[model samples]
Target: MMRWLSFLQLCLSLLLILPLPLEAFEPLTMGAIGLGAVGFGTYFKEYTYCKFTECCDDRSIPANIEALRSSLNRYLFGQHIVAQHIIPALSAHFQSRSTSRKPLVISFHGQPGTGKNFVADQIAKALYLKGSESSFVSKYLGQADFPQAGMVDAYKARISREVRNKLHECPRSLFIFDEVDKMPSGVFDTLTSLVDYNAFADGTDNTKAVFIFLSNTAGTHIADHLGNLMKGGKLREDTRLSDYESLLKRAAYNLDGGMKKTTMIESHVIDHYIPFLPLEKSHVLSCLQEEFWRWDRNPDSQKNKKLIDDIIDTSISYDRTHGLFAISGCKTLEKKVAVAVNYS
Candidate 1:
């Protein structure tokens, strides 16, 4: 039996390597070859190569917008505009069976700790089974990746090559550029072509990929816009993307950052400018409650309220106007919670 199996395996290897037409083989030989190929090919492709390649599947693409929506709604705190605009845009983008004219480029503009990076991670998680850790996902930090101001030309070439290579490897790749405000000017000029409508120009169809730029460039504009709306007695939920989209674009374009004077923005390669509003005091409290629950420190209502208040007064800083909004959002809440839990 072992001898027969080895003979069959050898025959299969030869058949695969030679690529002989099926018509060249006799009917019985073809049948045996087909059986052997199916058995061994299935084993190698499914169990062996999958472990190394992180084989692509339905999860490799953005298929379930509703799942993403649910995740953003549940875990992402106090960014209604983000969910409202982003979900619909993503839904439309993924729903279209036709090839895209351009890559999906979204610029997340907001203050730090206002869920910019968090939302990017959520999008990655929804698209790939491994989420942000997926091989297809590439995250770049501006200051970290391109620190030297004199290395603009070098950075541009390197970033373009990296992006092209990644897209070549996985066309459905997700590229997140964090702290984009810190990157050197013209660094992204190399990427304008990759994110543009052109397809297969350099043997890579980039239209299926997604590029996300997270910046604090227009954070002040976003917060001020929201503040103005609030001052006029307008609810944050009532404000639309239109209210802040133009403001953010203008700020990003005018601001002295990586995005300034870039063709990607001027030519409108960026499809959406999603604004993350500053977190209000109520949002901070929600974050605190969530953190406490995460730590399994479910104190009584009074004790929990006291702890939250103490944390807010001691650690959290509020805006000067009405003391309604948190300056740092929930970025520091987890650490503060840990300390509070340890002490109390």
Candidate 2:
């Protein structure tokens, strides 16, 4: 009897040490698991929808051409020509919508510190009303989006998909590609199809979307054209789009990586190549005034006046002889003013 009991105990210990199949464990019922998954998925979907569509509730986007112009002028200083050209084109495009019309594609070319990016932002802000952060607007930086030559193709594919996805979310989405001068050559070529007429299977059209490409490709040529006009005894205001548009286009086409050789330009999908002339001292001063007002500094105060004067006098300019423009345009003007105000 004792031997039999010892044998029974050893068998029990062996059984406990052996592994069991995974299926031996109890599991949740299919119905219960499915219901929990559905609940979580539904909640996630609604949460994402609310986050993206929140900007839509504002409805503060400029409704008319005059409103757009006012917003642009107030926010972006010394872009009078850009406003004059873009506003009319925008008004016409907004008024007319048809299957035959392609999406509006505008390229802004200028030096750094010029209001190229600012103007682009104001345009999208006035139209989308939610600013650049909206779901309706997709902004890309060339360096940030495409870091390597090997990644250009992948970047192109992703960009096309993002544009389509944004359009699906909001058909009239805005795409801003900043620093096109640094973008890969083939990247923008991919946008040609979308920029033209895009008819999807779901009966959705994306031709009304806007594409803005900002580059510094034609900056020097634009400045040269203006300098030539000045040398010929012509006033800067007298210079028109006709004078520099062709030159600017040619200069861009000559560039190696920008939109010049791309199909977007070859096929003429770009509607405008608006030039942003270098800012003069007066323009910089105007920018300074705008910055000061933005800070709520007392404009009439003698201390503030002296502060503004000292800041302007000390700030570096590219053309010291003429002092026509700051080296960084209004890019550093605001910071300079802030520092002066804080110290004084």
Give the alpha-carbon lDDT of every model.
0.84, 0.74
Error of 2 at 114 (Å): 1.5
State each model's C-alpha RMSD to the native: 4.9, 14.0
What TM-score, over all chains together, does every model reach?
0.86, 0.79
- Those runs of model 1 whose alpha carbons end farther than 4 Å from true positions after fitting are 1-48, 51-53, 59-62
For model 2, residues 254-293, the per-residue Cα lDDT tens digits are 7855575788878888889899887777777778778888
**Candidate closest to the true structure, highest TM-score:** 1
**Full-model lDDT, candidate 1:** 0.84
- Indicate the TM-score of model 1: 0.86
lDDT of 1 at 314: 88
Model 2 regions more than 4 Å off: 1-64, 98-100, 198-204, 320-323
lDDT of 1 by residue, 1-344 (tens): 67457657776787775677767889998888688769767656665467556765453454567789899878888888898888888777767636677778999999888999889998988888788989999999988998887999999999888999998887788899999899888889989988987856578868778889999998877887789888899998899999998998899888977998899888888999999999988788888898989988774578777999999888888777656678899998889889888887
